[model samples]
Target: MGLGRLSALDPKEPVRRYQRERPGELLHLDIKRLARFEGVGHRITGNRRGASQGLGYDFLHVAIDDATRLVRPQDRRSHAMAGLVQPAPAAC
Candidate 1:
């Protein structure tokens, strides 16, 4: 890439650096919605008219420490569902 092409970008300043102190200093919670699959879908099973049914999604909660990049698997803090709160397995 040449400098002429790079000059077109807005705010051409360099990106800032970030650093954390300790392992448990900063943490971030993430909720990922995953679809519950019971059996083969219509596409896979070659049944075009077959309804997939009411296969709701499962919310996976994950807590990660930004500093050490260590995953702290815990529950009860982040529950995406409104009525019931459940903890997903740590396999994900």
Candidate 2:
């Protein structure tokens, strides 16, 4: 279907941005998993010999305050729910 026809069939609501009044009023938490790598990759080495495999992944937990735009980031070896339950360390 054409873009114009699709929009007419299903109209989308107007986009709205929400902002917290206070610094601690709202916090957005997100987790990202990054692959673990050792030494240089084949892209640079031009060879796949001795490539590291099954090294596991690292999880990065990020928290952002809606009002103040403050960010808190934490790195963890695993992405377990238990790790999130615990408070992030004081040091970033």
Candidate 3:
């Protein structure tokens, strides 16, 4: 079998890109979880004593507009409540 025959065995799909004509036409939402800590950690304090325990996490909510490329980011305390929060007015 030749090298060309091997590549022809598995065909790949072409990549597609979509763009919105208006600012509010499309929006992408994302959530990121960040660790919560109190005071300085061992990296900064050089001591692991008095470490905080049971500290929860903070959720970062981000929204991006497809056309205008505008981004809105918000810090939330709970993931459950993150979805309940309302979106801010568009600056455009």
Candidate 4:
């Protein structure tokens, strides 16, 4: 049988989907830190003797969209959570 027109259905009605969408619509974020290791029989120290000894960690933040495949980078040292607040959609 052929499918009938959707005009009979309410315009505001919601539809369910079996498949998932990708890019643009959704965004993912990730964070990473830099580490320093000492040689054998040696231990790492927190004291900074010089610029080389001032080893520190660097945080990496990333964002990926599910609909557009777009990636955006944020700050570091912390996890940034999206979807906490809803924003207006951008122009396509």
| Candidate 1 lDDT, 8-40, residue by residue in tens | 766668999775776555656677777776777
Best by lDDT: 3
lDDT ranking from best to worst? 3, 2, 1, 4
Query: TM-score of each candidate?
Result: 0.62, 0.64, 0.62, 0.38
Give model 3's TM-score versus the native structure: 0.62
| Candidate 3 per-residue lDDT over residues 1-92, each given as its tens digit | 55567777786788888998977678788889988888878999899888899898877888787887878777665444334333522574
lDDT of 2 by residue, 1-92 (tens): 56666567786799999997866667778889998888888999899888888999887888777777777776665545455534433322
Reference-based TM-score, model 2: 0.64
- Which of 2 and 4 is ahead in TM-score? 2
**lDDT (Cα, 0-100) at 53 in candidate 2:** 83
Clashing pairs in 3: none
Candidate 4: list runs displaced more than 4 Å. Answer: 1-25, 35-51, 77-92
Q: Per the 3 Å backbone cut-off, how many clashing residue pairs does candidate 4 have?
A: 14
**TM-score of decoy 4:** 0.38
Deviation from native of the Cα of residue 81 in model 4, angstroms: 5.1
State each model's CA lDDT, in order: 0.57, 0.71, 0.72, 0.48
